[model samples]
Target: MGIVDSKGHLYLKEDPEVWIKNNPASRLALVTSFRLNLENGVEEIAESIGELTHLIHLVFRWCRSLKRVPNAITRLHKLEHLLFHSCSRLEELPANIGNLVSLTHLQLSHCEDIKFLPNSIVNLSKLTSLTLCHCVSLVELPANIGQLASLTHLKLSSCRNIKSLLMSVANLPNLTSLSLSSLSLSEIPYNLGDLKKSLTRLDLSYCNNIEFLPNNIANLSNLTSLSLICCNSLIELPSNLGQLKSLSYLELYYCNKIKSLPDSIKDLCSLDTLIINCCDSLTHLPINLNVLHLKLLNFCPRFLPNGLINLKYLRVNICSCSDESFVNWKDPYSLQHLAISSCFSHCNYILKVPASLNQFVNLQVLSLHYKKRFVELPANLVGLAHLCLLDIQHSSISCLPWSITKLRRLRHLMLPKDFRLETLSYELNISVIISVNERHVRKTWEELKTEIGQLPIPFGGEITNDAAQNPSIMSHPGYLWLKENPSQWIINNRNLLKLVRFLDLEYVELTDSIMQFSELTHLCLDIAADICLPDNYFVTFTRLTHLSLHFFSVGKHKSITHSLSKLSNLQTLHLHMHHSVLLANFNMPVSLKYLSLSYCNNMRPLYDSLEKLTNLKTLDLYSCV
Candidate 1:
């Protein structure tokens, strides 16, 4: 029989007439799966479920008030999966849960009152996965947990009081993934090295109390990814870490105690991405480092690696550096992206763009954001033939660089907020200038579009009048002319208004005329923090599937919500506001599948309104206070 609502009254009656009247025998022989999710008032389940002997899957997700499950459920012999995710009031599981010999997966994530798992669970030799994330009261695991030979994935992330794992945990021969993040875990069991061949990923993020990793961790030959974020007490990595041949990605963020990377890291042949952020004491990188393709070295600008000539992306915040060292820097051979910023204390000092910038022939993007310190661009930018994006904000430069006007391939440009021109000495031949003050940028963008769009037809290349009259050829000019115009030409084409499927407007005035573009599937608007959405502004885009809004103020929360409620087709919504904007209550579209909130520091504890969004599959929050 299929499961009904969690309420006791909704369960099948004792009489066979209520469920499968023709063959009542099917209840015990044929019923295979039961689900009763999102029911709020259920406190306990009826004991009559003991008759379901063939049930394979049981789910009770988000039944917030459920205090306990009936112990008689242990009678099922064929049950393979049992889940009670987000059952906040559940205190514990029945001790005889191990009676289900066929059970393979068990999950109890977000069960706030669950304190421990019964030792009887160790008897389920076939169990392959177990998860107890966000179980605030769970303190320890059974001593014989390693005896489950078939167990492969184990997660105990955000378990408040768990400090260490059992020493025998490493004995699980088939284990592949282990996650123990956001906990007070100070030490890993010494025998952890025993899972050398099976384990592949290990996460130890937000474990502030962890002082160091086990030295024998290098024995894990199959390990590929390791993360150690916000582990403030960690002083160093194991010297033999290079022994792991399969390792690819390594991240160390805010590990204040770490002084330098071990030189042995040079041996990691597969390493591709390395990020070392806010490591205060780090002053140098490993000498022969060459495995990384992308490296972000922030707050430690004094150290520059020598063999990184092949790097594709590099971002650095140099806090302490001399004029000589800054100017003598060499450009990477194929560097495509380079971003330079200074620490707050050094923001006001004059920092010249290195003359060596002209050597980066392959550079495609360059950004600088030192308001007071930045003074000029290299006099000769023509050498950077591949340059396409240039972002210069809060700089002290008095005028647009003369060489910049000659860049034929440049597509996008972002100028400082305070910039305004009273005279035009050189023509801006580029397609777009994305800036907060759109009045000036938009006007310039339109003028450039018209000038290019109205280019006279070449005398020899002119098409016949008969070809121009053909419906097929006249309907699609882009197919034949796309290569002739500038790279950004199509985006600003006058006849492309209806063809535009995506639009991003930042710091621009909101007018009713914007609603004319009914073909938009994705739209992003970033208004000023103090501005509010215009009334009746959102109903026009009935076809938008993805939308993003940024920089909201406190009073605009209600208006934002009202506008969002009209977008019934939106599948993804993102809101980014300053720390002071608080959102207490709002109505979200039932169609939304993904939602993200960033920098919303004052948002109250989100509860009821979120629970109503039953279709949401992912929710992300970043840097919220």
Candidate 2:
């Protein structure tokens, strides 16, 4: 007995001669954990799995289609990990869950439909991690939940509906990490008399309506990190916080109401990191603050606190008085990282960075963003040989000077999109420009890559490496290294030819594909408004398997029919059209497994003909007009 295809396909008729029978764990146990199945279309679990009590892990994460766990699951005494994360349809946990006291990890993240936890959960004293992240539908926790004294970690991030903790959390003496973002508690209870002594990290950010911290927070003493980044209404801190000798980090950015720091703070000489931003109205720092060697400092640059003398790093986007640099450092100290984000619009100052930075020979990273009409790199920048990243983005300057070539050690040089370079290596490829996120920025850079690759702007397209030879694209770090070498374009095509396993040609304007990327397995061509598959366009791409077409051809009623019968390995097809028709009958082969057509206007005939695809297992028709 096991689950398959949204039902319990009971293997009740197994031949008696068969000695080796399959079990629940036999269903792909290679993965340690898989969560979020909200769209799997599974309506229920079959009762057959009740007999597979030996299974140690059961995860039905985000199973929005399943309203309940099979009743037979309670017999799984060997279960060690259970996760039903984001299971919005799950309204309750099996009451017999208590019978499996061997459970050590439980996660019910984003289970918005659950109203309560089974009281039996109290029996899991061996639990190590419990997460109730975003359980917005939950109203209460089982009163006995706190009985699990062995609990070491608990997170209740975004449980907005919860009004109170079960009070049992205090009993879990070994608990170390706790996050209670957006809790509804009016006040933290002082009933513990002491904070959880073993607790090391605490996050109470965004609990805005709460007025006070428990007085016992200091007694725990072992706490190392505290985050209150957006507790805007917090007016006071418990005196106990000052005595936490182990605390290393404290954050209070946007807590605007508080104006002063407690004298108890002087006891935290061991503090290495502190952030107090957006407390715009209050000013001045305690004289004893000079003893701190803070690693980072963030605040309105115009209203810098006076006593931050040994600050190691500063991120100030304020306008400094004409040619003036603040003196909050002891001739450099640990000031190795600095970011001055904004330049004054009105003042025409000396435009000199502080002279003290000369003592900071160790400065390795500097970023100046969104500057006014400033031009040219600062003279001090060229000397910092150790500097690895320099970003002067969104500046009024239009071009970088030849002095930039001296930054031999620099790895990432970021500037505004309009900035241009003249005499740089012709072999440079924009693909080397790394992006923090894979979105429009990536496409913009890729478009630039294809642009820069096609014709090295301002330089002749004479690739030393002939395209006839295939070379490994990954061996070369910088495309510029291939200059004056004939084997360059060969390497370029080798790099781009089959390198893109996932193709995202959203708005590519090529009238015809010029090259064959035989290894391209997945293609996304949404927003390709006027693109039409060329005749015999994909004939050479034998490995093309998955294709997706979406949005951008609005009201055009474009006819898009193609012969992909050669794609014998095709597995999935996804289409999203505003108005289009199959120009010709699809020559889909037998390997196709999934097909989805979305937002297709006048698509009834196309689906009616899809019945010919007998091998198709999954068909999705959504938003089709």
- Considering every candidate listed, which one attains the maximal lDDT? 1
Q: State each candidate's clash count.
A: 0, 6
Winning candidate number (TM-score):
1
Q: How many residue pairs clash in model 2?
A: 6
Error of 2 at 441 (Å): 16
Residue 153 shift from truth in candidate 2, angstroms: 0.9
For each candidate, what TM-score against the reference? Answer: 0.61, 0.57
True-vs-predicted CA distance for residue 414, candidate 2, Å:
5.4
Encode model 2's per-residue lDDT on 164-277: one tens digit a residue.
876667767788888887887666656543445778888888888777887888876788888886777788788656787888888776777777777677677557677766
Candidate 1 lands at a TM-score of 0.61
The regions of model 1 sitting more than 4 angstroms off are 1-42, 49-57, 75-81, 99-102, 123-126, 319-326, 341-356, 367-380, 391-400, 406-447, 451-625
